[model samples]
Target: MTDQTDEEYREAPSDRTHVKRYHWLARYDQETVKAILDATPLAHVGCMMNGVPFVTPTFFWREGDRVYWHGSSAGRMFHALEHQDICFTVSMLDGLVIARSAYNFNCNFRSVMLLGRAELIKDEDEKAEKLRNFVNGLIPGEWERLRPVYPKEIKATAIASMSIAEASCKVRTGPPIDDDEDYTHPSWAGVIPIRYQVLPPEPDPRNLPDVSMPEDVLKFRLG
Candidate 1:
């Protein structure tokens, strides 16, 4: 993900005032937002169909709370949300955001779960715009280089929008936790920062011999 200015992101605290069970709605920090979005690839989108609740984890690209996804026009998940209410969630775990106390120990993460109704964005122009957002989010400049979506491609897929209404953000960070008695034990106790990166890209064998990886995608330092 591109480095973002602090002012570019915003997360609001949940309405719950008590920190019981999981204080999911208690924290609204920028670090929390970045950690979650940067750490994971899949997002579980919730929707209701025929009075039954359903959730499907699919490939997603997030821009703030607004998420865009496309799939076969006939798929169950896509069909279910074609004209219904839906919710989307994106989460990423960056190592263990743990601490030295039971209450303090927490996972380092940034996750945003949103609720809102969805509607198929039938406007051809709008659909094209959303598609660009998804491609850019995955690997910048891909949409321009890859073949443009054909009119048939658009007709064969379903694209929709979900308003980011009520959302909850939670996060945890720091070192490992130990009981009062265990705290005195001499043991290593700090986080080992985890990282992910993309190796050199491999070209498809069927391609006419010599296409190198794109600079935009190759420049990524996956963590």
Candidate 2:
């Protein structure tokens, strides 16, 4: 795990962080924002390209107040990311709130939006270390068992990190909120819970007969 210092986190909010609608759902605490980011792995990164908007989905991880993501060195998206300001967002849907009236229908979810400029990590050693952290953090003990990352492989990837400079978390949960008159309607209303499940690992057919699943593989879980 990456060591986080007190200075890395602070209650700093920007004009864009304020939630105008449903202001009660906004969360500004650093810890709360970090929790949402940690629970979600996929982030939709939005940036400008040639004076036009562009968004790309990629796997990401958080360490302290910084978020890191990588892509092929040959990708134009990576090139654009390094030179422009970006918005990174992660969201997870928890359930559907079915209400008597269509106007009252909503979904429960947790999400975070961060805005910052990405700094390309150019040091080879630093890149290797961060890459290892990403892999081992996702699957404990897996990095050591796999073949070492080659220099060519490292050279073929572009890794970048962005500070959690301006960020906010918004969440909506609990039962449906309907008008008093709508409650008496014939239609039913409640929350349909949703959860993520991890299935048993499937081994490759070419594996040796004596090989078996590792302890980490059997205990893998996701939020």
* C-alpha lDDT values of all predictions: 0.63, 0.84
Across 1-223, the per-residue lDDT of candidate 1 in tens digits comes to 1243333333344343223345433444545544555566677888877788888887755556555677777878877775765668787665764445546455555566665666677777787888887777678888998887898887777786664445556555556656767777565466766555567877678876666678887776542
TM-score for candidate 1? 0.72
Residue-wise C-alpha lDDT for candidate 2, range 134-223, written one tens digit per residue: 888788988898889999989888998998868888788889888998888999899998977778888999998997878988877664
Off by over 4 Å in 1: 1-20, 29-35, 38-41, 50-52, 63-65, 82-85, 97-106, 185-192, 221-223
Worst 10 residues of 2 by lDDT: 1-10
TM agreement with the true structure for every prediction: 0.72, 0.91
TM-score of 2: 0.91
Candidates in order: C-alpha RMSD to true structure: 6.0, 5.7
Off by over 4 Å in 2: 1-12
Clashing pairs in 2: none
